[model samples]
Target: MTEVKKQKPGNSVLGLFKEIFNWYPSSYPAAERKLLFKLDLSILIFACLCFFVKFLDQTNISNAYVSGLKEDFALNGNELNYFNVCYYVAYVIFQVPGMLLMSRPQLSRWLLPTLEVLWGICTFAQSRVTNVHQLYALRFLVGMLEAPVFAGTHFILGSWYSGPELFKRAGTWFICNPLGSMISGYLQSAAYTNLSGVGGMEGWRWLFIIDGIFTLPVALLGFIVFPGVPDSPKPFYFTSDDIALARARLARAKIRKPGPLNLDVFKRSLARWHIWIFVLCYICMIIGGYPTSYMNLWLKAEGFSVVQINQLPTVTYAINILASWLGTTLATIYPSWTIYTGATGGMVFSGICMIVWNIPKALKFVAWYVFGVSGCLSPILYSTVNTVVKGDSEERALIMGSMMTFGYSFNIWVPLLLFPTAGPNGAPRWRIGWPVAMTFHILLWAGFITSLLLHRRE
Candidate 1:
């Protein structure tokens, strides 16, 4: 898995263009070159910033629990895990339409930003929750608000960018996620140690309030900068030939097996070679990756004081950012093989961290740092959808849309539903992490191998 590999390709640009013609039906407009590039750059910047803030608000809960909420609510026996579950349930329910609508890339300019504001408010509302029920309601709504985020962003990026370009854009988005996580982790740590003085609010509540305030402005900015396909917008640079190409692209999109919530698409997605492989792979990567969300509580349970607990999550996330950058950079420079090596090493490192649960508490932290290497893979994979599947713009959009929706469903469910449970015994029971973490790696490596083989066969 660590080995770098190469893809078979025609040597010349013309051969590459011809290969694209065999599978790509989406035509381009002969727009003014300068305007086309300008609009795309503007949108990409806007979208990346929006994603960055959105993540900051979303991961606030993890911080809240570690800082104060768990003690105030006296949460016990997987309550935090339940918190993960609640949001995920709502997240799973709403992802499909968000993705499918991208079939008309035109819809995303409005759709993406609108959802941002709605979810931003939900994150703000979470600050006011006085009990578990209220937390549940607010978190659930936040999930619904956030449903379109990853899936929506995936479509938007793909609509404007080509296959090779997908990794960087997807990496751009994933980088936002960890950056969000890092920010949230640090904020959570800080709230616990210092910021509990805003109108008698607990540190957790203040965390939500602060996060909301941060997100609202960015959401507004999204409208001004969000990018989509060249034909989808007004005042775009397009020649008559380019317009014809764009039309052909849309026509091709229609035939790639798209429809409204149909069983066929669902079944096909489930049977997709990528699906089970990813599930097994991610289940472990995520399981190993669990520390990102749970690190605060773990720090406390492991004998760190509140101030120390603060440093734990923030530091671990810093390591993850480094890992994410390394992984993405590798893929960017060596598009053919960096990912598989990163994926295996990352998952296995995460497992080893957990497996050696008793060796020294410090090693778990190191393990998390290593796990960060693969932390960005899922989102990067979403960006790579175009490479794996061939369709006209419309059909390709549908496939990406559907896949992203389902992909988020996995994101929503796995953390909350599949995460192991323990007791209200007031101690972190991660001792059982050995088999659990090992199981995760076995499945994930299987996924990497499977995806590699499938990509090779294709």
Candidate 2:
């Protein structure tokens, strides 16, 4: 007869607290806690900073658009939309290749930092663009460099943390997106006030310059301190025993060290339900989530000052962080419930808000709020993908890359095709786009249900 292990009662207050935070699993030894503290301090800190800066760099373009880039470069008539799409096209093209290279053990140490530095340089060069073509070229380069970092970092986090630990950690890491936006808004406000006309650069140009200059030092630090995966030599903070424990824990969890890219892994991953279902879920999530750039665009058209436009979006980001924290915390406790609740609930609320947006100015702001908050689905979706493919390193990498690749691939054209920026005579504000996005959100909800059913069946 098979032995049935008894489940522990998680009723103790201390136990409940730890479980809620995903801190210090009760089974951990004192030494394990010490090691984890070190890992969290060194690895998580750098990873979060890298992601924070990357997003800040990415979103600064939107800020620049409002500040002065559009006027300075003579941008009119779909050029801004095209510029946005160019980044994603490069992203779709380069993400998988970048991940392939980053997964190599020999290149793992240097690839991320090198890419960060290069992208930072590319971002800085944006300040100097004289025309739309120069802006497009630079955005593509920036996108290419940024392609692998998000998914690559997520994969690394998965490699280090166990299944239960992964969601909250990913939440904390992903929260940096909102945090970055908040910080960038403030930074842009400061730059526009203080740096305008300095060195003949517009405040928006100064924003790019300052953002780029800040990135290189971080790249240097990441190269020095960020721990690679367990398969590599132990980081200086980790003892040999800590390394052994790390490997053993992952081994017991069936996590595999990544191997070189090959046909067999691709064939096998394509055959798996988890990869396809979750990746499809991801594509829907991207389509259904709030449009970041549109919020600023709307505010700009509503006759808000540049600073008001910059600052208002931070409120959206604030609400986003709360929703994200709530969703991830609930997911840590109940994965299925959080998954269903976030996808279905957020979509319904956002769809209604978008549909009824014109009733009041307050309603429009509320629609944007709900849309931003709905971004909680992003990390939940990513964590689901990470957990589903945890044990196979190559498959995990391929799936992660493919998930982003296809998601961005859709982004390259779908928004352009479906969400027209203007009607005849250059009228602004795509109110029609909101309902279109809401319609897609309904489709996304269906996709989530199908994915859940598929996952449950497996």
Which structure among the candidates has the greatest lDDT? 2
Whole-model lDDT, model 2 = 0.75
Best by TM-score: 2
Residue ranges of candidate 2 with Cα displaced over 4 Å: 1-18, 290-293, 424-432
Clashes per prediction? 10, 0
Task: Mark the 10 consecutive residues where model 1 has the least summed lDDT.
Answer: 1-10
**Candidate 1: lDDT of 210?**
73
Q: Model 2 over residues 1-458: C-alpha lDDT tens digits?
A: 00111223287867656666756666888887777787788778888888888889888988888888878777666776687799999999998887777677666667788898999899889888887888899989888899999888887787788655677777778888888888888889889989999998889988888888878988998888777778775567678898898888788777788876789988898888867776776787677663644677878889999999899888888887776766665566654444556656666775676556556888778767766656467676677666667768888888888889988898888767655555542223446655666666666666656765666666
Which pairs clash in model 1? Answer: 26-249, 27-245, 29-242, 30-239, 30-242, 31-237, 253-394, 253-395, 281-444, 284-440
Residue 30's lDDT in candidate 2:
84
